[model samples]
Target chain A: GAGVSQSPRYKVAKRGQDVALRCDPISGHVSLFWYQQALGQGPEFLTYFQNEAQLDKSGLPSDRFFAERPEGSVSTLKIQRTQQEDSAVYLCASSLVATYNEQFFGPGTRLTVL
Target chain B: AQSVTQPDIHITVSEGASLELRCNYSYGATPYLFWYVQSPGQGLQLLLKYFSGDTLVQGIKGFEAEFKRSQSSFNLRKPSVHWSDAAEYFCAVIEYGNKLVFGAGTILRVKS
Candidate 1:
């Protein structure tokens, strides 16, 4: 099985445009996570999901950021009215038991908002 | 709150030389630590992790990390550096349920 997969490895969007990033976690994985990594910075937590339930989204910068994982397989992170500050590499990860276990990460989607 | 710190921004080393990347963490209780590496145009690969019991943990790509509870650090090390090892290394800690808090990252440049 694949570790984790994110579509459109690179994206360029105009300001105020709506965008969506997709993440497909490992099959049968119960935990899914999203993170944002600015250039030269580490990945910061964006959201977490367990079995299709979003447990935490406290790290989302603003109301324009939203994510959902229906049926707990694939997840979508949608940004409404994108801004320049939103430009970064969006990463996705998945784990088995989800108790600090080893998390497998995707290649990441590099989003550029102009 | 849990936090990870990678003091060095960039490190340069010669091939076949030993390498060490420092990592310091802050957490109230015992910390679950990890080291991940990202090569150019590649996904982040887990190098190693430390939960409990073992102080020294070995991982893929001939890398190892030590969990020093008293020092509040989980530093990654490799006995011999390889050209392919030149990449960005990240130290991370788990918080809440399954979220990871990562350090700013350290870029390693291997000299031939």
Candidate 2:
């Protein structure tokens, strides 16, 4: 793809439900990132991947949030037992490489937990 | 720990007027700074970045930002504002291992 692509542009889940969001990064990109953006706030870092290796998970908010980039290209973010506080826009970004390169973002998935 | 601060939560500017958005950062070493713009229902687009070299870096949409080491500030500016420029702007600092630490965004409202 010419740019990063994300699926399920919008999702509504009830409390205690599990939801998954997917991301397809730009071809040949070596770095991928996930972020969460709350209403009227800046995007916060969630996790990072260098190819298929999950190098950084320090920013994940809680145990309910898990992300995986199995093939180094496509990634998935799964939230278990979703809470109302989990409602936010999940963003995916990719860069040519991890160092100093500008990241390209995808139209995020807006998840509303009820 | 690296962090960014955007003091103004909202800014309103008339079309054709000059605009400036303030940003400050706290980091131990030389910081890699970036500015991004996000429109309604859209993804974030990088406006400009400051890694090294000249303090003033030019970006797309007639935007520019100056990185000052002493004050730990990287303020974004545009000579003239346009209605199309209404959007949320974010300031971020690249942390160790290429992580991005972002500040609370500043929403810009352009009046025509």
Candidate 3:
């Protein structure tokens, strides 16, 4: 793809429901990242992947949040028992082989927990 | 721990007026700073970055930012504002392993 692509641009989930968001990073990009952006706030780091290896999950807020990149190209962020506070825009980004390179971001999935 | 601060929650500027958005960061060493712009229904787009070299860096959309190490500030500026420039701006600092720590964003409103 030309850029990072995210699925379900908008999702409305009832409280306690589980939801999954997907991301397709750029071809052969070595680094991928997930972030959470609340209304009127900047994106916060959620997790990072270096190829198929999940090197950093430190930013995951709680046990309810889980992310995986099985093939190193596609990633999924799953939220269990979604709460009202979980409503936010989930963003996915990818960078070239060099970690410090500029990240290309997806349009983001707006999750609204009812 | 690395963190960024954008003091101005909202800024309004008239078209053709000069603009400046303030940002401050706290990190232990030389920081890898970045400025990004986010338009409605769009993803963040990198404006500029300060990895090393000159303190002043030019970016897309006629934007520029200066990194002042002594003050721990990386402020974004533009010589003239345009209505199309109305959007949210964010400052971020890179941590080890390419993790980015972003600040609360500043919403810019350009008046025509």
Give RMSD to native, each candidate. 0.8, 0.8, 1.0
Residue B87 Cα positional deviation in candidate 2, in Å, after optimal superposition: 0.3
Cα lDDT for residue A76, candidate 1: 98
Residue B92's lDDT in candidate 2: 96
How do the candidates rank by lDDT, highest first?
2, 3, 1
Q: lDDT of each model, Cα atoms only? A: 0.93, 0.95, 0.94
- Residue-wise C-alpha lDDT for candidate 3, range A1-114, written one tens digit per residue: 488999999999999999999999999999999999999888999999999899999989999999999988899999999999999999999998747777889999999999
Per-residue CA lDDT of model 3 for B16-99, tens digit only, reads 999999999999888999999999999999999999999999999999999999999999999999999999999999888498
How well does candidate 3 match the true structure in TM-score terms?
Answer: 0.97
Cα RMSD for predicted model 3: 1.0
Better of 1 and 3 by TM-score: 1
How does residue B99 of candidate 1 score in lDDT? 91
Q: Tens digit of lDDT per residue, candidate 2, span B8-95?
A: 9999999999999999999988899999999999999999999999999999999999999999999999999999999999999998
Point out where model 2 deviates above 4 Å.
none
Worst 10 residues of 2 chain B by lDDT: B94-103
